[model samples]
Target: MEISQRHEGARGTISPSGSLVAHSSNSKLRPATLLSHSSIRTAAKEVSTLKWSSDSANIAIVSNKLVEVQAVEGHAHPTRIENGSGSLGRFVGADFVGRHHLLTSWEFGRAKIWDLSTGKGTDLGDLKTTCDEPAWQQRPESTGDIRTVALLTRLAAEDTLTMHFPELSTSMQPLKLPTVDAKSMSWSPDGRWLAVLDTATASPSVYFYTPDAHQYRSYPSAANLEGDGCLGVKAINWSADSRVVALSRYDGTVVLLNTITFTPLAVIKHTTTVEQSNLPPHQQTPIWREAVSASNERSYALASQPVSPPLSRTKPTIEPVELGVAEASFSSNGSYLATRDERMLSTVWIWNVATLAAHAVVMQHSNVRKAQWHPTRASLVILDCGEGIAYLYDVATSSAPLAVNAPLPGSPTLSWVHTAAESKLAILAAARSSFWILYPEGAESVSDDARAGVEVGGELFEEGASEDSLLDILSGRKPALPYEIEESYTKMVELEMGEADEGADVAFDDTFREKKKADTDAVDPLDDSQIF
Candidate 1:
């Protein structure tokens, strides 16, 4: 194929025949927006649920009433596993081995090993779905509530992956559980531990399990959970480093737990009722005036006003921040964390992992269901904002996203692959029949320094910081300065108006001159000579 190129001096475009044409610019692509998209459909069945493994190149989608598997690089057709029919198919943690995943099908009353590579599934069996233990049957009065069903996996020393399903002993058939209707279950990144939440109990306990050793550990989170969690935890996401797992409870509490030891990191208190507390002494100040007794009957005017009855405590309605922790995800590089609220306001919260403090929040209109940091450009992240739209957000700028990229074939599971050689591609589970293809529009080929600049916007403009600290602020956590917002907004407005302004046409220029002359003709009392 003969490739043709045309250069238009400082600004230009080239169309090459049968070859990918490249554009080089002294400045990065303006707006850095999602220009266009193509559609792809999945062929298995309607994908009701899906899970993307961190390490693997496959996505486990529960379709056709079975667990459907597709390789990240594979074509539209998925290897369908017909087992787990009529069961609530759950994608548990993927094993350390190749594309093997731990799947729990509530209908089958068992967890299964799904070999994505072989398109096969092995039943690991069930736990007592109900708390119907013989010990309880013997002493009916003392029978406690059997709460949850969980599946945990551990890789043995010989590399064989073992799955654990907690059981309640029975006489006739061991009354194997129908499977635990868990509130939430999360696996550590290394796949060494699993955490389960039992909402059925009076005080739900967070259980930890290690399948390799065939052991179960429970946390002491016996906080009398009040609300009936029938809908249970909507979502759960582990911190990038796997040191923390954020859980979103139905009752509106986003619980953060240290993964190593089941300890509460912070119980972020949230209530629909916005309460106003008394202002601190330093913050509360009253301006006063000196009273003068002029005559016998002195009239004194109050100068500084008394603090207005500490603004009436009105219930400020803040959107429920806790929408079940599962709705959030950590960046591949572990620099930022993101989640969405009940009101559909998706927030990308960039953090300093070392300090665990939030640095920035990228607010979007749609309720974001999934988000991941670009594997190569750690500061570049993409979000699946439910309703067919996906957003590519540069964690660094206040400018609204360059452009909102939509997944083809509609709502598909979006994921990222961080291979050493692969271009950071967005794998979207296409229309239940295909996987939509997405590649980084502009972030793919940029250097880390350039990417960092895009990620942090103008944070690099600050003075007196070390190179390391500057890099951190550019790609890490640095509160945005007010100027950044104005600058980004200005740039966005300019981009919308078109980067290269054609200048005013003759007719427009004539109108502009007339308007200018009319404005100049307005009366000026101060200087008559200048006014004329």
Candidate 2:
């Protein structure tokens, strides 16, 4: 099957089988179009396992846990310290600071500051309630109130560590803010300000904190919210210029706002019901309904316009956009945005700063999340598509994604190192929870050519196999796995919208409601009179 993608003026179309069509005014895409064509295949018939290192990468994934850290490039992975009987909270977020320090925080009540260059993890302190010390210039009394902290380390070589420790601040401090719960957090590109999603109020609002002054500023006020219906704010992305912020709400509303003025730039709404109609004649375009009628009247009258009769309307359906698993990320250049839904499909969308329509739905991933742009290049992106698979895509051409056959002994997470002088290579946290330095096949590198080549083929040795046997079995491999199978799958069958309807506007009546009601009502096997 040939897939064709095309751009026409402000809107773009993807013809999965050379038949798809859509219309839009703003460049930002509507979710309806994304769902119709952005179906990614989740099944990977074949996969490979990977090696690991924890210190050299920013993120790590194992089993159901994800770890984010800024470990030294050459040091051994830092030892994890467990305190009390509390759970060991998986690392949720991490960032490198000035090339020397790695900071981490978790959903569990703990945060740590580590020296990445020396592999020294200093418990610069815990946010636990017992450590509060007004005498030590530290507020240990406020530990339980803390929820999440956003750490910022501008460069790996920098000396400062900035953290949004609202939960640990004492009353004597100048900025005495409420006990806030952070749902999301981000830093300005320049690293001067940190923005937070404050869920402490009836209507959650974004708050800004300046590290130097230890003060809080409320830029966006509560009056701006439309209602409680807007509360499902799941994710946020920052513009590269630090002038705008894009937010995603669970209700399917994606909005871009002016960071300085706190004003909405555009709001992209989503819907699932397909609205079908015909276009008017080439000479004169009529209203949608009139155009449909005119086409049916002219049996063969060769009208100049192209039109078709209207089909019956159907009830508008709302397709659920997964709230929790989807994350918002901005391209390095800030010209576009990308997100992955819970269903395993990811999309790169062109962002029009002025209007909200998505100009193009660049590509989709079948089972990937965590996508980021090449720090020095404009078009390239890397993503982990679960199942030990990863992909690199060139946005300019929405063709087949470039496959990166890295071994992910198990599920893995990815992180990018920013490079000022060269295109940075991705650091993949290996299956052992360690990190590996990976350079794509054609990417430039200065390492010695004597290094071992990427292991492209292998078979997992049985439990009874020896180490030497395993090494010899997988070494110098070709068509390595004799038991592997190859097969092709048909493209996803389009979910037919609205059942064979009385008209296009009608909706299907659910039949299970009565059954559920009978189950909860008085036990009656003979409710036949009310069965209808």
Q: Candidate 2 has what TM-score? A: 0.45
Taking the tens digit of each residue's C-alpha lDDT, what string does model 1 give over 430-529? 3433333345442355554443322111122121121111222334344323212223322444565663456543322222334446545552121111
Q: In candidate 1, residue 85 scores what lDDT? A: 20
Give one digit per residue, the lDDT tens place, for model 2 in 322-390. 443256666777766665434324333344454444433323323345677766565667766554555
Error of 2 at 46 (Å): 30
Task: Provide the lowest-lDDT 10-residue window in model 2.
Answer: 42-51
Tell me how many clashing residue pairs each candidate has: 18, 33
Q: Top TM-score: which candidate number? A: 2
Which candidate has the top score in lDDT?
1
Cα deviation of 76, candidate 1, in Å: 20
